[model samples]
Target: MSGFLEGARCSECMDWGEKRNTIASIAAGILFFTGWWIIIDAAVIYPNMEEFNHSYHACGVIATIAFLMINAVSNGQVRGDSYSEGCLGQTGARIWLFIGFMLAFGSLIASMWILFGGYVAKEKPIVYPGIAVFFQNAFIFFGGLVFKFGRTEDLWQ
Candidate 1:
């Protein structure tokens, strides 16, 4: 028995959970910055091009606000726990989270709409602006997900 149980688990042993969180967080940060770089590149690459629409940038703003809101609420509140019940309550917190997701997804959908309806429909079919907006929203969404769920085994967890 002594030989079999010679040693117990050690504090120096690798913590897989922490490792996963660190990797996911770093990847999410890279994606976030890459997306921003795409947006900036589009604006700078063809500065003299008058075909680019100025209003497309608004989608980024909307997504940013949603990102902020999503991060503002505590995870406990989102899960509808007792602690979160004190401030906004379970229902309120859920509602707030819902609104945040809607805004985030809406930004994504809006980018597509602008691409198809505004550009494609008009037969101009510009690639830079449309793709930039879509990538921005997508990366933000992915980054938010990674930030929010990286610590957990799964999203719902």
Candidate 2:
């Protein structure tokens, strides 16, 4: 009896540990939203939160790819079976799901920060964090697109 759908588990590859993907994805999600908040924080959200520093959106691109790949790995697992390209679709689905979640949660966090205690990092801009965040999102975006568009494996094949 099948229990429940867990996560993406590719066959052939004995070592089945998408932990890195998970970490990367989570990091991407956090940055994507946080970065956005920072970029737009200065809007009406706060009387005085708008300030443009250096551009680090390039990093966002990387994070996006990471986020998408994370979804692909976790959602397109094929344990005790062959690798199927269909799994790619599963990964894409997972990515979208995360997107929905991020939209909802991101908004909530930004709103809370705007209303209650304004989030930090606004006072000063850090090049490192911005760069890191940009890359995380960038990776997720590319990874997901590739997975969705290119499904070479059957996951369990």
Candidate 3:
């Protein structure tokens, strides 16, 4: 009975590990897709420039760029284990990661600023566009985090 239980528990652990990777990937993808979808919906609903300023899209664009930058460097490369040939090497990876994070944070903050300053503070307070912008940046930032740190790097190797 003891041996059987042990075997079953081990198998369960393995299954869970495999499932975790899939779950993380799916969650990240959903978040990213939903973020974009919301922004697109907002744009469609408020096509006029007066209703929804097109310039606000720049925040989402910057956030997307940050997401790409954050995921471009693998865990091994950042840790100096699997990458060392480049001129800057691990340090470069670290710097790049730092810059990515900074951009992500900056984008999120800017979205909040737009929400408050552009919409909430206005006399009429038309809020759908501002809310959409804020949520888009928030979802993208969180999705990037999930994609970066939620999965086990060892499993991929």
Among the numbered candidates, top TM-score falls to: 3
Tally clashing residue pairs in candidate 2. 49
**Considering every candidate listed, which one attains the maximal lDDT?**
3
lDDT of 1 at 21: 69
Model 3: CA > 4 A from native? 1-3, 83-87
lDDT of each: 0.74, 0.41, 0.93
Clashes of 1: 0
Lowest summed lDDT across 10 adjacent residues in model 1 is found at 4-13
Predicted structure 2: lDDT: 0.41
How much is 121 displaced in model 2, in angstroms?
17
For residues 11-62, write the lDDT of model 3, one tens digit per residue. 9999989889899999999998899999999999999888789999999999
- Using all chains and alpha carbons, the TM-scores for the candidates as numbered come to 0.77, 0.27, 0.92
Candidate RMSDs in order: 4.7, 13.7, 1.6
Per-candidate clash tally: 0, 49, 0
Q: Candidate 1 lDDT, tens digit per residue, 63-157?
A: 87887777677777677654436566877878888999899889889988877776678787466677777888789878777766665534345
Q: Per-residue lDDT of 1-157 in model 2, one digit per residue for the tens?
A: 1332222233323333334344444555554566456544433233332332323333343344444444444333433232454544655555656664464344334333433232244544423333333334443444444343333343423
